[model samples]
Target: MPRALSTPPVIAPGSLGGSPQPVLPVTGGLLLRPWEEADVPAFLSAYQDDEIRRWHTRRPSTEGQVQEWFEAYRQDWKHEKGGHWAITCDDDAEVLGRIALRGLDFDDGMAGVAYWVLPAARGASVAARGLRSLTTWALAEIGFHRLELDHSTRNHASCRVATKSGYLLEGTKRSAAVHDDGRHDMHLHACIRGH
Candidate 1:
């Protein structure tokens, strides 16, 4: 018989009190800050990319929907449900991408990460840098024991980002998620504390 898994310590309330989200500095003068209403146009534009649409299950199609999404992000933070940030370059008003720690389970000391870089920002290692910065903060500042990042198995680019950011490829979740085209096998990657 296999041993039962041990329950991890729960994260304390207000541990993630950086609501309105603090600006995290990344390589190349990039910053990860809270999403703002003014960014809605850029957010909508980024989702128009076929690659973004292919990998992300949800894409807001209208300005109102995008605003709603931003509101939800605020609510998530206010309720301590999760954290989301817009990746941008210093001295620029446009968003380069987005990275988030979602599916938060304080009792398990775990959370799931997700990201998307704009087409213009692809091949610049922007995603990897943002992922590394976020993971570091989540583990060190927020005290999460484990962070998981998963992507469609077919997304080789994302696989590279995950590995480059120090996430180890654990395994695959067979047909774990449904895409617009069909179901996708997800490649599961994780970074555990003290690893």
Candidate 2:
């Protein structure tokens, strides 16, 4: 029989999602958990906004494309890889955003972080709490040595998120890739294990 999870004050090394996936209870102004089918409508609304599109890779995605993306999101958890979580309010469990570590590399001990919050949740502490919790788990439980995040140079809020999460400003990649508007400047940031 499988062993039951033990409570640890801090993240436990290699304790995230192996023998049995741990459901971390992270809270700030809100709480975070794995995504649910009920969150689809709210998730769609957040992704459809103009500003959110501007910061993401898909700016004007078709409904079909969005559905496909959503499907992939649903399937991510089942894979032997990383998964996304929905950020919900603490007072009322209304999903306000999402945070995830995609492209997980257990062997290499690394992962790339990504996140987004609904406009209503902006200025709230949800993002910070979610980012910190996820990072801590990835480094401690998942045994990752490095965690990296990227943002467009134009996205000041995203940049702030990275800096606030203790990621170092590595440098800029000039015209590294084209965006929906056919222009681009990317800012790369990273946080290493043990400070």
Candidate 3:
């Protein structure tokens, strides 16, 4: 059955300090939908970019690896785990970026978010809209209570986005993980649903 687009179950407008509406359809030159096999090439191209790879756990260095991840992305949605959508613009349908909800824990009412926009798409508010759409859907439709997003301490841009999007700046963990160069600090953000 196709998911109907309707006002989600229960989201108090004042929860986020404004009248929050359920996510609108893809507008403003961006379309977000589930991943497809053909999106492998686009995913590879996006992930391979040096700037994006800096925060990514592992970069897709080979076509075969990208192919595998692409398949896994499909399986994620199929198996009710978590996944992302290709951020395409309406004018050219250009796959300019991606936003994802991975590591879902349904029983605990939580999920982790990750996203990136091509450098060309930066400063265009694509990331904010993408995150809002996905998070609203996850909270109201998917019955999740809290959404979590973590970014490296040095990635101030991500921190600003998270805060601006109603995510509370929880705290920072020192030496939370190791990157290619050395230990990295992690800043965590979270949003809890309203009754």
Candidate 4:
């Protein structure tokens, strides 16, 4: 029989800072920081990509919708629900992509990570680097026992990123979620702390 789980302490906003957001530095001068209003254009552009639209459900067609999306990120962080970071180079502020920890559950001591890189930023390991950085922070700094990531079984690029970021494939959920094309089987991957 499984033992009763210990209650994890509630994570309060500003415990880490005025905002519970983290700015992570990645390879090649790329830095992951909180998404800003200035990044809306780049965010919209990245989402216009076929791959992003294919895999993710939320697609904002207008600039206002994009702003709403950014606002949602702020709300999430302010409430200690989750964090979203824009992937950008240090020299320029243009967003290259995004990475986020969503669906935070303190009771379970777990969260889900997701990421996407602009087409121009692909093939340079930007997603992998960002994922690794976030995973490390989530486990060490945030005290999460497990970090989970999932992608369509057909998304080979995501598979590579998950493996390269040290997340082991756990199993597949058949028809777990619906995508643009239809229901997709998702491969669940996870990295547990102290493993």
The number of the candidate with the highest lDDT is: 1
| Each prediction's whole-model lDDT (CA) | 0.91, 0.74, 0.75, 0.87
lDDT at 81, model 4: 76
In model 2, which regions exceed 4 Å deviation?
1-21, 59-70
RMSD in Å for candidate 3, one decimal? 8.1
Segments in model 4 whose C-alpha atoms lie over 4 Å from true places: 1-20
TM-score against truth, every candidate: 0.93, 0.81, 0.82, 0.91
Candidates 2 and 3 compared by TM-score, better number: 3
Rank by TM-score, descending? 1, 4, 3, 2
**Cα lDDT, model 4, residue 144:** 87
Q: Backbone clashes in each candidate structure, one number apiece?
A: 0, 0, 0, 0
lDDT of 1: 0.91
Q: Mind giving the per-residue lDDT tens digits that candidate 1 earns over 1-195? A: 934547645697666755457889998889999999899999999889999999997989999999999999988887778888999997887799999989887778999999999999999999999999999999988889999999999999999999999999999999999999999999999999899
Candidate 4 Cα lDDT to native: 0.87
Regions of candidate 1 where Cα sits further than 4 Å from its true position: 1-8, 17-19
lDDT, candidate 1, at 194: 90
